[model samples]
Target chain A: MKILFLGFGNVARRLAAIVTDEGWPSRRGTFPVEVVGLFTASRGSLAGAVDLARARAELEATGRFDARHPLRTDMTPLEASRNLDYDVLVELSPLAIEARGEPAVSHIASALARGRHVVTANKGPVAFAYRKLAALAETQGVRFLFESSVMDGAPLFNMARVALRGCRVEAFAGILNGTTNAILCHMERGGSLEEGIAAAQAAGIAEADPSHDVDGWDGAAKTAALANVLMEADVTPFDVERRGIGSVSVGEVRRALAAGRRLKLVCRACRREGAIQTSVAVEEVAADDPFSLVDAYGAILRIETDLMHPLVLTQEGPEVMDTAYGVLNDLMEIAGTAERKGEEP
Target chain B: MKILFLGFGNVARRLAAIVTDEGWPSRRGTFPVEVVGLFTASRGSLAGAVDLARARAELEATGRFDARHPLRTDMTPLEASRNLDYDVLVELSPLAIEARGEPAVSHIASALARGRHVVTANKGPVAFAYRKLAALAETQGVRFLFESSVMDGAPLFNMARVALRGCRVEAFAGILNGTTNAILCHMERGGSLEEGIAAAQAAGIAEADPSHDVDGWDGAAKTAALANVLMEADVTPFDVERRGIGSVSVGEVRRALAAGRRLKLVCRACRREGAIQTSVAVEEVAADDPFSLVDAYGAILRIETDLMHPLVLTQEGPEVMDTAYGVLNDLMEIAGTAERKGEEP
Candidate 1:
């Protein structure tokens, strides 16, 4: 599988490292994944298959791609995408939620139009244009799989797609964002919301602009993505009834604890009156609720289905590796090389 | 798909009903599933194609199979199995945990030997002869799937098999038995162990002879099945370091609760040193543990891997429908009829 990466950032770099590392054992020998092209907005793009380790060393010491580097090209990601011979395109660009999944959507649409499979870690395209892209992929007979989009590569979507096939997802409630969860945890430890945000930043859970985490846009985006893809609701982040924990006080947190409940930034989605209702709010959950047991750095998604009882999935402290492995798993699936079965390592 | 059912009990009856009920809405269109044969130890046997709804009425009215019942057979399960024409064999007989999975194992082995796919709800085969059956299926180019064998169709094994492909399992700990959990829950409410057992039996959580559940044999079987299939451990239920909650006293439960911990029957497996180690025992879990939140009627499995963070799966109050759906889901996967993608309900 020849892969074209849209960004050369942390997740993408780790993906390349894992794919290229011979010491990393994949089941049933190895999958033939070659990095044929790479494009970065700041770092120069590579037009053809090249060794990433050599390129990384050059980029670190020389600070830029010039005549010294092989396969270096001046073409933009769009131009290089058409020129390069690749089987799948992996998108790992940073989230631009404010612009509603901008250039990423355009890039994916272009790739789909050209009849190429796509694997992405971007939430914008899924949150903003899931219906349009899914319909387009269906018309082309190729798939648009983003297993890492919503839950940091926890395999929630794939579980719904494969193992739980024929079962309709009726409703879901989850803690999708790690940032606000950390802030809530901080508040439970006697810190105010302001101090909580700072603590989250210090722990690298909150980004420089904490608005997305505190203002509920992150959770709203994830909710919209899940609702649109799994629930077939053509909704966007803007449609969510959003609230955040910005108003939470330390005293309120203590009171809830005394009452045997803990505050959480809960994301919920369900169909009501023939339409999907999406919301992200801070609520007091009982001690017995699975949502209350997820650690500050963890996440949990509880889904009700037509065929089974209430099913819940949880994850603890996902890092870049989780998201990177998710993208790699998607690539393997798109390449139809995901035949790891009937064995133990 | 023509299905040969080895037993016509509650689970098989529900499966037939769900498959034939026109009012039930399955995703996409209906899957063509026809009951071709059934062999019950006491409920009688039916061979060839059967309209289960009509056959069920006849069996209830007559209470025996004779010339009046179409396709009635005097052959044993093995004899009828050889004469039947079917694509897959489904085993839903009573658990023969004490007999090391008994006749169900023989029935499944016969089906696999003929190069046919097998989906079973029996744990004995998997716990006692997983390596042999799996090896046989591989050599015959057939699959032996038993998703309902553990966790009551929570999709744990399938999750490890499909969604987490290429990832290696490092360790797992779970509350896998509902009867023991229910008993412990009753004890938490100031009930004695004897009272707890009576309550479990009264609530239908325990069978007439609840030894398999209370004595930890059921969990041990599931543990061995998981270890044998997922971890490549060739151990049986008898090999598990097993203990039961029958020794748990009410005062001990109260003491654990006062220390902010809960008593649970935890089934665990890990590769220790150079071999797989399996255990099923009653232990105290912290209040914040995911196991602590699982309801008396619920179950949870936490898995650690080398590729990603700790992944957890949970289910609440599973019933006959959950196990029946599991069998149906396995049938769909085996028939190559699980092509559900790029769409919504």
Candidate 2:
């Protein structure tokens, strides 16, 4: 399998190192993956079968590329995706949630147009243009899998596809954003929101610019993506009734906790009269509710299905490696599908 | 898809009624299923495309069956499996944990030898001869799926296969038996074990003879099945270090509860020193542990994997319908495979 990575930031770099270390395809009987292209906005791009190990080393030694490295080019992700030779494209660009999924969307569209499968952790492309991208992938005979778009690789989409086979999901609620949840948890325990955000940022769980996390854009994007995937609703993040944890005061958090409730940034999507309705807001969850018990770094998705009633899937901790594993998961699934059809993986 | 029910017990009967009501193959775009045969230990056997609705009605009217029912004969499951024609055989016989999976093991072998796919709720066949039966099914080009053998329809095996993907599971701990967990939870709350058992029986959660559940045989069987499926171990119920909730005293439960810990019947299987070591026993779990929060009727499976860390799967309220749904889930999966292969389902 020939692969290319777009936006070689922390996620892409980690994924590349793991792929290189595990000898790509990792001896688990899947087809060997050869990274054919590497692209980034500022760190330079490489085309035509770049050395992944050397690229990873260069990134580790310095913030960007070692200029002397072979195959380094001044190309962007969109340009490389259009001109490069690859079978699968991994999109790891920073999410442009409010910009209607710009560079990542274009990168994905270009790859799909060229008959290549796309695996991504970027939420913008899915939250903004899921239907069109999905249609294009289906039309082009490729897979557009984004298991990390929601809940940081907890296998939510795969759960809907494989585990909940033939069962209809009536509703779903989750703590989609780890940063905001952490802040709220801290506030509930007598810390200020700023204190919690700083703690999370210092721990590398939150980004420097905490606007998206605090404003609930991350949760809204995830909710929209899930609504699109599970409920087949052509909804975007903008369509969701978005409310962030910023409005949740420390006093309110303390009051809720005293009243046997925990204030949480809950992302909920439910099917009402055959249409999907979604919201991302601060809700008071009872002490017994599973959502109330999830830690700041952990996530939990409660899906109400026709056959299984309410099925709870919880992840103990979320990490960057978890997001990278989601991409690998999608790749393995694509390979498994090919293998099932008796195709060379 | 022609399905044969080997044992017309609660699970089988519920499945048949659902199939009849929903007109089997219930939407999700798989092949339509027709119940071809129905056999029971004492209720007699019906051969050659049994009318599911009529059979359901007959079973509902009489606890067993009426002699006047058409095509009824005094035939055992093994005999029916051999003589009757079926595409899939559902092994819903009474679990013989102490018998080393007697009738179920033989019956499964008979069906697989005849090139019929097998879906079973009985844990015995898997606990005793999982590798052999799996090999037989693979050799015969059929699937031997037993999702209900562990945690009813909680998606344990499916989670391992689909969600875990190439990720290796290092260890797994679960409350596999609902009845014992219920008893333990009740004991923690100052109720007697007998009282808990009686309440469970009243709620149709326990069998009339609760020896199998209270003796830890059920948990041991499930542990062996999981060890076989997840670790690929050739182990049986006899191999596990088994201790039931019967020996747990009320004082012990109270003391644990007072110490911010809950006593649970935890079934653990782990890869220790390159060998699978498993045990089913009453253990004291901390209040913060997810396993401690699961209710008596609810079961929780915490799997430690290479990539996903400790992934927790909790199913609230294991019921007869839940087990029936597991059988349906497996059937749908088989049909999905056939559909993908473009075969007549």
Candidate 3:
């Protein structure tokens, strides 16, 4: 099986390295998977342009790669489809829902239409058009997996759909975004709300504008994915009632701390009166509670079930690198299963 | 697919109830699994004597049952084998390793030899004779799933084997036994060691003797399971260094608390120089750390991998009921795949 990766972003770079290091093609039981080519963003360079010739020479010296295929980054979706003879596509690009129309989405749609399996760390397409893309995947008889879209490298999607199977999921809630959680933790530590936000930006944990992370749009998109795909709930972005952390005040933060509580931005999706309701809000959690100790970029999910007790799963830290690894992990599962089923691979 | 439960312990009772309540038999998308009969340890009054009779009654009222072959709790394994007809054998009997002369192990072996698929929550057979039983399962082309054996209801086996595929696991450490953790947590909360033990007994959380839990034998068994299955490290029960929380003192717990740390009984398995080492010890964890917040009966696994960072997966509240549910969850996954493969329903 030959694989093509679109965009040399953090996720793509990490995945490519893992693929090579794991010896995908030569692993004892592997089904001959090979990373054929990589395409970066039009503005970026291949493998960060660390001298492809030099890199290839080094890999050859180490007896790792016999040959390296360098593809131009500026190819259109149609161009990529016609030129690439790969069995699977790894889509990792900057998430853009409105303005740029997200190259990852178009690339994924094109790959699926071409009857190639598509694995992605990109949440844009899944959150915006899950049903459509899923149907397309079925029609093409390929797999479309996005485990990293919700909790970075954590198996949030798999846990909900597979691990917690047969149990009636009464509700699902979590501290989904790390940036907002980091800011909340800072404020609870006596830092002013503005100071916390500035600290997050300084640490490169938050974007300059930070609208998506701070305004809860990023988390809303994730919650939508969790609801529709994981829980099989029919819901959309517009259905959610989002309240970002931008409105939280320093006084309120201090007051919460004084009362032995910490302010946490929580996202929840649950069935209420036979309708799925999604909400993002800032709530004060007791200092002794598990949510109170969630550090910078840490995520936790509380799945209330019809059983005697609820199931709580958590993951710490917010490294896009892990999120990238999560995407690769999902691909491996789908690819392995597909190969076992005597598919194209 | 008819299932005959071999025991009426906590796990068996819970699983029977869940299978019935879910309308499992009528769920056509997956396997054609159905609960046909149940056998308890006691005779005559066994069905009525069971604590959760309401759950049993509810299942009987809705779920299809073979009236001509009403569940019998008194029959010997050999008698049941000759008289009853079941496609699957679910063993939830109390674990008895030393009593190898007893029927459980032989019954399991007989079930496998008869081409009956086995799903067990018992650890005795697997922990004692993993190689023999695993070989038997493979020879018979039947699934021998024991997700509940290691960490109660957590997806430890599935996560280590399936979720973390292709990743080089360096080490794993966990709080494996909930009963021991609950006792330690109680002791940390100003109770004497003896008092905590009493509290556990009163709460029905600990066994009468409690040696298995307090002496670290229980965690040792679980650690063995993790090392052998998850890390693919060949290690035996005798190879592990076992140390429980029985020796912890109030002064030590107080000092650890003063140092902003908490004491926890930790089970660790690591590969060192191509050799596997397993141990159970007491460790001091920082208050703000994830393990510190793990309350009574909660279990946590910190899996160190060669990836960007370590991944920690935890299941809160160690309850047999939850563990039973986890086992049922595994059965569902296996049954689903088996059905898809056109195996015997």
Best by DockQ: 1
- Cα lDDT tens digits, model 3, B202-244, are 9887889988788887777778767777676655555679888
* DockQ for each model: 0.65, 0.61, 0.38
Considering only N, C-alpha and C atoms within 3 Å, which residue pairs clash in candidate 3?
Answer: A178-A297, B152-B323, B153-B323, B297-B318
Worst 10 residues of 3 chain B by lDDT: B43-52
The candidate that wins on lDDT is 2
- CA lDDT, candidate 3, residue A10: 58
State the C-alpha lDDT per candidate: 0.82, 0.84, 0.71
lDDT of 3 by residue, A187-282 (tens): 778787678779989987777878888888878777777788756776656567899999898789889989988889888988889888889889
lDDT assessment of candidate 1: 0.82
lDDT per residue as tens, model 1, A187-274: 8888888898888899876889899989999999899999997788999999999998878788999899889899999999997888
CAPRI-style class, candidate 1: medium
Worst 10 residues of 2 chain A by lDDT: A22-31
* Error in Å for residue B75 of model 3: 6.0
DockQ score, prediction 2: 0.61
Q: Across residues B177-282, which tens digit of lDDT does each residue of candidate 1 receive?
A: 8899988988989988888889888987688988889999999999999888778789999999999987888999999999999999999999889888999999
